[model samples]
Target: MRGAPTAAALTDRLTAQLRRRPVRAFWTALGLYAAVWWLAAVLTQLNLPLDAVEMLTWGREWQLAYWKHPPLPAWVLDLLYRLGGGSHAVLYLASPLFVALTFWAAWRLAGRILPAPLAALAVLPLVGIVYYGFTSPEFNHNVVQYPFFALLPLLLHRALAGTPASRGVAGRGPAGWSAVGRERDWLLLGLVGGLAVYAKYSTAPLLLAVALLLLCHPAGWRALAKRGPWLALGVFLLVAAPHAVALWTIDFLPLGTPAMRAAQAAGWVERLWYPAWFVAGQLVNCLGALLVLAALALPGRSEAGLGNPRSALGFDRFFVLWMLGLPLAIVLAYSLLAGQELETMWGAPYFALLGLAGLLLLPRAPSRRGLFAALGLAVLLVLAGLAGYLGKNLFEPLTSGRGMRAQFPGPALARALEAEWAQLSGGAPLPTLVGSFWLAGNAAAYGEQRPPVFIEGRPERSPWVDPAALAETGALLLWREDEAGRPPGWLAAWQGSLCPQGELVLAWQSWIELPPVRVAWATYGGRHCDRPPLAAR
Candidate 1:
């Protein structure tokens, strides 16, 4: 007991260290994020998630807009892929990099709301949230949106408060127009806001929230009336112009996609249910996050030192309510009215402010004991998330029956298809594949064939494939294998309709399993291949 420090002594030491070294504390948090995610990425190298594959395939095409989503993630991935010289390992860095920037943004915002050590403490709960760790490896649009979302409020705060040189550099923007003082911050906000929108239309809620805040708060209204807001709006519009043009040229193709159409057709009951379901999903995801913050609420040594939620005043209170809360409310309201189900991943970037909210709502400044407890909870969750991810990677295949896209043997199937094509066409370019996006995308990304994918057996989705050339060059049509080793029942019927003269055969097949699973493949058009020639084997 002689060497054991008293509780008060230990608390004093930790508080002193944390308060004296806020920057070091932030880097420590960021270091944990990078190490944990990078380890998972390296260990999980055998397979790429569906979203990551989609980004890779779309990145290959360098398209202005993808069929289902905006182009930012694809654009960035494309650049990263090229920069990585086609190394898949480079893709792993994407999520963690964005997450680090997001955390930095959150930390900066927290500094404005709390003392240095407390600001660092504020971010711990958020870092433990699963979205920033487990789900981020996919590095989809949601992950891409994280930094922008985190940066938006911070920029808005600086612009609104006329706080100079705190959030962004003061200078002339891309338009070659110099903005000094308040206008500089507003200009940068516009740019960030515009880029966020380009990243995903979901960012509209944040922009809407900003608008509401300006209307509701007198100071915000005054700031908006100045040249800064207008300049910001102009910059935003300019940044968004290309996407708008792309949408127009295609008649807003995203709105007409099957998913959107299905949502549009949902009834009133479904509409109400969708947002309710989304809110519920958010709660589930935030369980670990909430637990970390709850630890901060435990009674500490001094009541006055414990910050109260009601103690938040002026801009901080407005920020918690409008900046953080309003966007979520708008998303829920829109989902309910539209009856369109929001995917759980869409909520990934929306909670970057959770830590700031946690700090502002505390009735008193956190005691050292509470701070350490919250950090412990956060570290516990981070370890759990990492363990779960590793377990899935290690044990998932052994169990079988699970057909996660990552577990698919895309490279082997691709090799098999290439050999099959060489046998049939005497080694011309593999040309194209007519199939659903998932199968075709995997083949293109991981398979050596590098054939273009015509989604859903339709040519329109693959504009890069020349219709005439594809006809001459031939194609492989594929579908997922059913439980019984046959193609899915509906695909079997479609195959019959597609090749009335030809029979669907198990042209190529591959398997992977700690337990054992297989994907079935078939050919449709090849030079040496004849129609209706093969019996079902």
Candidate 2:
């Protein structure tokens, strides 16, 4: 009998197999990513992220924009949640969908510059990317921007890089075809770019990058002279017009909100230190991708210089450079000047094209086995991440006695409160909920009929709420028991004066038992919601 296959032989065989089936393997990897991450979301999280909860409440009502961020994400969540029969598990699907779009767009862009197989392999590092992996289950504004970021560059790249004929792609179209292609590309760019802005104002940085490139780069200025760009502008304005009108007429500016509860630093040391720290954090986030690329370079069975970035086949270096580099530079400069505290997640979309960047610039090109190994490394990273996440959320709560937000029994709390409200008020979704966004928002999301949260009773914060109607219609108020005296001063004055209901302590939904979460509920409007129109009784 043949000797048992050696480790080296098995590895070679697997790599050879991967090499032959790169496109299939590429798709398989993406599918695996989406499936397992969704699994993790279902298994690990109970309460969605604060952003997700906020969206859950806002999503109930549609608009071009919310008081905070764009409305596209909310629109998506609303449709997805309703489609899934109000099950929050479906919310997890959005993250995977956004990430897959980002990767697919990046893949298509890469294919233009690299071989089809290598293009597939180029995006393998994305699996190991932190934002795309460990923290991906949360569907929020940052998550929503992923596809827009990828597509923005891809559309711009295609528009600027010229058509199949112009790029020497084996066929020439009829005369004026290139001009038509450019206009078509511009039209698509306008559509994607417009939606991107509608997703978040943060898109300004990239748009600014494009503007700067157009102003300063030779290739960029030439493109601006074409009528295609003006057409793009008109399209963009048309898309933004609704929101722009809203902003212009709205009483309060929604651009900036209250400061974060986190501490800010001052003095020269902090200014310099904070920006540097932000940059360093980004690099650390990118460490996994770097390691994957480094691994690809580690010998075995790969060719060197795959897809030569130096190829004369029309890869707009300036377009790629500006798109990839400027947004981060703008952020870094802002942080340095403003001493703005940077949350790593804020950079979520900055590196959507990182895999493409590595493929373009990294000196070594992996042989098929090398590429396979890199993808394997990416799979390992994801599995290890998922395992750790599951373990932490499931087991660690037992020792800590306090569960993370993911451990909060959101649906259970909503169920209990709704039952009490129905018995008292003859059945409705409790009208509305007030108090902290966390508790009230959670109740609003899961409560019968999915009521809305007043969000601290601030009309601007919750423009959907008519204060006069809220006062007259009344709302059931909720706050976490542990945060007794923490309500806003005005809300606190009423906490004492309003109908003070008792507390409900519910055990966290984790493995084994952890300390139960205590939530206090009360009603405002008149009596216990059974009696009608009076004032806070």
Candidate 3:
């Protein structure tokens, strides 16, 4: 009885503290969670994933836009490297950092609609979801869009709620219409929208969803008729003007490349099932979080909380449904009509509001016990994901011959390539690596000089490379091969014809279980010191 009383006292104390400082507690948990993942990354020395490598390669130049995606993620990566000394640890933190921003945004948005404790509860399930934790190590465009998705909902709620006091009492009238004409709200909305689009084209779904919701709802249609929507549009155009120009300059190459066009040509069966496959994958991805939430929620309680669909006060529920449902519907419809192969991961950023959706599905609010349970489960799942990531990077290769990219001996290969380059070029520093993105990117990252990487031997994809300067400084034309063998047919022919005298084979061992991974490398123009300044190109 004494022990039980002491435990109760301690629990009460914690409950009091949590009540007093909910926001602080939320942030502290987020920071600790991020630290755990970052430590795992550092300890394992995890190699950057393929997309991350491409991001790093693209980020090195700080271009207006990369060949594949928008420029913000690359810009953020470049900024992180500049700020944190370009270490791999710094690169790995990009995803966690963005995810935390998303969590904060979600918490803020939830606070708008729910009590502080319930807001925290709503965010717990989201953090448990695999999209935010397990698959977030790779800081791709999808991860980059998370914060924006969270922010869009938050801003949209505030704008639609029309709190005139928040917007400086712009023609105060009814609560719903008070801030409809406020220039500040429109401008902010437009700014966030433009930035979201600048991050990824996938953000268009949220944007389209918001526009369609407004057109369908009477109040929203009235608000849209005001100057707010027009102002927002003008601001979006102004903010997006540079990217529009960049797109035009590049002849809209990012829009529909050969790969995308090929995807659009998928057979009818594939197209018909793609939506179903996407839905199934999403369910699988969120299964862990769903289980945790189910444990927290009451048994057999399944109902949409909003009653009376025609009530004016039901706008908030309608807003949630529109935001969550319409985007999904659009994706499903597009896949069905276009006959395109849709990767399930493309839905990564679209699910940030899943916790709120989960809340709507419940019959009642979660109790304190349920909240703590959900949070505990989420933390465990995150740690499990982190452990799996570490195992993949540090342990898997020791037992299996299958080489993981994370275990690749980038530094070893880089050193060997540098030595061969020095011998071939007579002391000239390797200025570039021309090969497939992964091979060259690994070498570029780990090599002493940190040379620029030209993706797929193409200069346009690598804007940093000046063709004339690359010719003057020379590049190591490199490609992977089967265990100390020669380059593939095309690469071998290219090497044999272009740099016959400079051929070199590198026996790079990424793991002991497997045979040494070989790279065929050839030097091009390092013979001349008349190269352009490294900084200039």
Question: When superposed on Cα atoms, how far off is each prediction in RMSD?
Answer: 5.5, 3.6, 5.7
Superior by TM-score: candidate 2 or candidate 3: 2
Candidate 2 residue lDDT tens string, 1-537: 899986557656645544577567668868877888888888778778777888878888786666767788888889999999988888889999899989999888877677665678678788777888877787887888888777877877666564433345423433433532478888888888788876777778887776676567654566777787778778888887888877766642656632352236677788788778877888888888888887776666445434444452444444556687899889878777776677766788888888777767655457556665675677688887788778776777676767888878888888888888877777754687887777888887877678877887777778888867755787777775334555455365454435666687887777676668877777787445443222344
Location of the lowest summed lDDT over 10 successive residues in candidate 2? 170-179
- Residue range 1-537, candidate 3, lDDT tens digits: 345555335434444555677677778878987787677766665467787777777888887777778899878887887798767788888988898889888888766666565566567777667888767877889899998878877777766666332233455434455555466767788899889877988788888887786677665676776787778889888898888888888777777742464466358788777788889998888887686777558443222221211222245566666787788788788778877667888888887777766665665655445544555677678778887777777677777757777766676777778886677667777777888878888787766677788776665677677767766667767776655554555464343324533334443234356656666565566564343432233
Query: What lDDT score belongs to each candidate, Candidate 1 first?
Result: 0.70, 0.73, 0.70
Off by over 4 Å in 2: 1-21, 163-180, 258-265, 299-301, 304-314, 483-490, 493-497, 526-537
- Against the hidden reference, what TM-scores do the models get? 0.83, 0.89, 0.85
Question: What shift in Å separates residue 23 of candidate 3 from its native position after superposition?
Answer: 0.9
Error of 1 at 259 (Å): 5.2
Off by over 4 Å in 1: 1-14, 163-181, 256-274, 302-313, 397-400, 419-427, 447-451, 484-537
lDDT of 1 by residue, 1-537 (tens): 478886567656666667677688679768878877887876764667788877877777876766677888988887887798767778888988999888898888776656666777777888667898777778888889888767988888767543222213334122332343367788899999888876887788888987777677765666655788889889999998988887777668765653554454258878877887888888889888888888887777632333344443445665755677888998888777656678876787789988778777777777566766876777788888888887776666557545455556666666666776677667777767767667667777766545677776544455566656654566676675655766555354345423322222222122443334344555555464554522432
Give candidate 1's whole-model lDDT: 0.70
How many steric overlaps are in each model, in order?
Answer: 17, 2, 1
C-alpha RMSD of candidate 1:
5.5
